[model samples]
Target: MPELKGVDGLSEPLLRLYSSLAGENPWVEFLTVLRRQLHASFATIILTPPTARTPAIVVTPGVPDFEIGAAVKHFSKDPFVGLPEGRVLTANEFVGREAYRQSCFYQQYVASYGIEDIMGLDLLAKSGFQMRMRICCGAGRSGFTEEDKQWLGYFVPHLRAALDLYERFEIEKGEENIYDTAVEQLSVGSILLDGSGAVIRCNLIARNLLEQRDGIRLVNNRLAFSDTANERSFRDFLRASGPALTSRISFMQAERHSGKPSLGIIARRLTMPPSLKLGFCPAIAVFITDPQQQAGVTGAAVANVLRLTPMEAEIAASLANGLSLLQISEVFGITQNTVRAHLRSVFSKVGVSRQSQLVQRVRTSVSGLIVQMSSGSGAPRRRSRQGAPLLHSAGAGQDRPQVKQTRRLSHVP
Candidate 1:
């Protein structure tokens, strides 16, 4: 790569671009700064090539939305198509100035947009994905020179690396969203905690549980039990489950107000996946199950898993929640006989005979096993029907466990 004079001026903008691509700032702002640094009238970064099926992602700051739309719609007419990848090409190289002025592409698209001189560099192309950077000078400005091309060449590698990093970051974000959505759909409340017992990330159910303050709640962004004794024990348990050392899964019971059933909590240590080592993912996954709350599973999941009708799935879900025939009838606004008829069909499809059997089967089959309360100890026990326990034992409690720890163990600051 040819070194450009006064390259120090590009350092700040390059750093900003890297940060923006990493998702810290807006990407358009970086593009605007980049266009100014190159002294171009307009600049664009296209992620996808102009094709019939896939729409290209053209990022051009300081350009009107209507012009952007027009450019994308007529992108196939772009003069830079089929150019050598990773090589900078000037408009004049493709066609003589007089010939280009008379071409349909120039008359219909380029002239209307006031674009006079164009220069583009293909940044990357792999598989079906392609990315390119283009800079255009208006009618008033002169065409890009050899010095301009050399300056852009010096930063091509940096732009490529930044784009790759941004792509990975987007993929990770998408995966995180899917994981969060799945967890939120479950009947169980999921809370992700860091090494310091502080709440890192949580789903909708967990947020609702915290807001309700039934048994567990958030105190200064840290997980806290309503009961002082239970809170102390829980804090100690979290402290012992640091990332440096692997610890056994722990179970704790939170006492609720009134005569309602106590909340069941199952905590297990989780190691950050190698791909997410640079992000803030919790080291501990805590599942909370309230006995008073009904088992809620999506009707679609039940239908797909058991191959039952929509009505049958709804009836089965009601049965799984320990609802009686009369209660199901009242809830569905149907007669008791109609309820029994649906129940029979549900039982036949689910391979169960009695209501108790149907409840047990649906509870275990559709939503996995429930956390049953242990007889001797008040702690909740995770019992999977497949004989694979969801959580391990917490081992013996320590007399004096350290509480304070780092918020993020593996994340890059």
Candidate 2:
């Protein structure tokens, strides 16, 4: 541990700070710790400036959040705009003590939130990236003293380094996400099974398919089929035998009240390398592809692109699949009014005015690309939910020309 000589109660916060980059609510834990230590109203991060298209991302735990801290972005009249970069400054230091108290911004905006004083730092990275962090005092909390400023200064270098590391992580993660992005676009239902043939994880496509309760659905978190013989074979394939094997089941999941059941499924036993063999990892992957699903738009496809809520994405995808408003309502078991309301939200977010325009937007999206039918069962499958490599399906002796093993499972009563 580096010497935190001047700063008191900083060791815990700093530990949380560096560890929070990958967490769901990154930095919230650190901010909470720091807020208590500093005896402040809030420790907030202004992640981005609010824009016409999207709202600013604010992280101020235990507050109205975007309303108070994000006010820095919306409020036009701001006297604290020009803080020295990478340096901590108090509100009193920004403007004269008397001027800051008398400023219209404080009276009109700051006072309403019960915030009495603010110690802020603006960090600008080499990539022209910027974020502001403020340690604020509310009513009855004593204003920041000189010791506070000195203590905060101790964190600047560490914070900058953490931010740099965070940016690099995001870049690397973005590159890795291309595989998932492609799978989501293809809309292939993928499920991962363990050594005992129990479902461990599934992608959004699998979730949606399982929801339909078609020929292939989940039974107690494991893959299930309408025919007993197919189910037995699928279970057998999921069990790890001496040699890793792959199989394909055709029309295994027959859609009830549908024109034709053309779902093609591929199951492969996986072999983990000696290094990656740790833990109770998934041992099988079942890749399900429905021509009807792959040929049309799936809700999972556009969810990331539009940043749409799951419901909105579903509604949009349904519309893109040539389903009318009534059809969407009927399929989802919701009222037409509710369906229209969600459609309107989608329209607003996507900048479209009409249903036709919305459908056109979904159809034109890269996610709308049709996934072609693979030549046979041995064809590769896409990535599963946050998994190991899917393309590296070949087990031991991967370079050898293994015999083309195929199991064409047909539905038998």
Candidate 3:
């Protein structure tokens, strides 16, 4: 048999192992190499990203098969014995040494596996993240030498580069899958606008919500939000939320519905491909809420979002459609002061101060959701009319208030 030359010479064995480890995770190939080269009673490889403390094991192929690729989380937290200064551990340095002899938890396991020594090569990324890749040897009386250290030092860089490439590839793959899933699951109309505020990507929900507007369509590989006043504001918010800017901009409903607070949140960075960094002006991820999906929208579906007393939500819904306190009182058969008091409480509970404020707060709370109401259809569709002192209807039976239309954008991603 040809002698294995550290990691490089074991390529043939690794190819065979890769077939078995192949699954959702692609990091398994490197671990298979470590398993073949170590010739140990057991062996494994770990890859830990900077954002996480938990080390994800990529491969484990031998006697201690159960421990294969098991995440060595809480390694840093172990006060019993810090990792030895050197990469490799000889029988004397491990089984015969003070740290191993003194460690109650780790010693017994090493003995049971018949593992006499270990060599842990710290795989470091060009990104300056330290990763752990370890090999154990139980070959009787034979141990790792300085020659092995030199071989690992030469092989480490190649492993690091390969791992880095694989990770980036995996991230791109995962992001693509997630984006597709988001497109399928979300109910809110989403127009992925570019830096110029043109729509770059739109799903069925967005197409349905935006009424198939042409201005928002792609023109010469760019999307425009249909030069409207609201479109301008949406573009402005997107710019503020972009990575080039530092301002903490938020997206909220342009109008509030009755009894519900407008949904708004700060947009954060979305994951993108490395290719985009060179010249790709990526679209920002902004959330829009759909009121119909809200928990407090007067029905069981919205009971949670509004967090209102059932009676209070009813009153607020009445007030939202430009209803006067007297009209509401007549309809509910309550006094005007009592209705006003309830309105005040409704505003406070829903995080609004006045009727106009209440309406403003919920406009962005739910997207593509016109309050499931018939009364607002006749009221002049006044887009800019800020405040209309609610007029009371003459008869109690005829007093129905218009419904508020709040926009909701959900973060399905």
Candidate 4:
């Protein structure tokens, strides 16, 4: 890195350089200006090398991409590439001018376009980030001078920083999208509330639940329940000051239609570090679970981990959700004896001798956290021939067990 006399007249191009990170074509404006300032024929940059599914993204500012002929395309690798990092080297300087002129790579690819002089800046990051920029000129024009090299050299560090920041943001954004999609697949509605009880963030599931207005909704941007008593309790929870001594979990049911079950909500306060409390930090997170929509434990997921037949896996998953042996039989249209037989097999394979042990094992299994995305909402529910959810308790419409029977059936029986 060499020091310049001064960065006079660099404000405009430097501004464009950093600002380009947020633009659709990040390097177009800066590269276009670089070409103009240097009086070059073309300014090109390669961000991502070609892959099996995507062609290399090669950007040539002010130059429309047309066929450069088969000969040029066939010369895929640049012979003048691999220049010393951070050093601006022209093609003539990189290789002997005579050798550069005689090389088939230049004669076939570059000469066809009347390009005589070429200057390149390459960044090879240890983190596998690669960027290369080239400025080309015609034979009639003077080659890139020391001043031109120094000007580009000044931009090297800033270009690297801007590119690094851009890549970091893209990776984080991609991770966020993946997490949100997983939440949607699990069918859990999430809502975030700030310290003042204002809505900070709400996912699509939460939005749909609020839109229904069956039991709870957004009232002036704050959560509200249909029942006045329940509303007061929620308001109290929101207004409570100071952090809890220990992590705590609270549950509340928002009553829905007359015959329908209430929406189950689990509220937990988020404890932020003292340093992060300056901003509008989310103080509470509310998760809504609809048992009617709960298909989180799928048979395929269970079978993969438990190594059981699909039917046995389904029975295990049902029992894990607090289903009695009788209810499991009714759900699968199998006899109680057959259901108990499957339960015994599940216990044996799961290394559990008792029915309750098998239930707990399945409940805590990896399958419990997995969901089969069969349909739009990704919740694949089991329905009886009567078009009713087999897992739900009729009339009661609660998330509790369908029957009050004991979990254990003796092996002798």
Clashing pairs in 1: none
lDDT of prediction 3? 0.45
What TM-score does each of the candidates earn? Answer: 0.66, 0.56, 0.40, 0.58
By descending TM-score, how would the candidates be arranged? 1, 4, 2, 3
lDDT of prediction 4: 0.65
Error of 1 at 83 (Å): 2.1
Best by TM-score: 1
**lDDT-based ranking, best first?**
4, 2, 1, 3
Per-residue C-alpha lDDT of model 2 across residues 9-115, encoded as one tens digit per residue: 77887888988877666667877877787888778765431111221345667654335434544445657756899888988788866787688877766777787
Residues 1-413 of candidate 4: C-alpha lDDT, one tens digit per residue: 12333443466667777887665666677777777777788887755321112113456665544542342354354577778887888888988788987887776567777887888888854444456777888878768788888878878888888767655544334333433444554577878787777898889989998988888999899898998878888887876666552145568888886547788887767666678665786767788877678645556446645667788989987877678889989999999999988888888889999878876676565323322221112233333344433221111222212222111110000
Cα error, residue 391 of model 4, in Å, equals: 42
What lDDT does candidate 3 reach at residue 372?
A: 15
After TM-score superposition, what is the CA distance of residue 63 in candidate 3 from its true location, in Å? 7.7
After superposition on all CA atoms, what RMSD does each candidate show versus the true structure? 12.7, 14.6, 17.7, 16.2
- What stretches of model 3 exceed 4 Å from their correct place? 1-25, 62-98, 126-128, 187-413
Please identify which of the two predictions, 3 or 4, would achieve the higher lDDT against the true structure: 4
lDDT of candidates 1 onward, in order: 0.61, 0.63, 0.45, 0.65
By summed lDDT, which 10 consecutive residues of candidate 3 come out lowest? 404-413
> In candidate 4, what residue range of length 10 has the lowest lDDT sum?
404-413
Which candidate achieves the best lDDT against the true structure?
A: 4
Q: Please write out the lDDT profile of model 3 over residues 50-78, one tens digit for every residue.
A: 43344433345322434422224235432
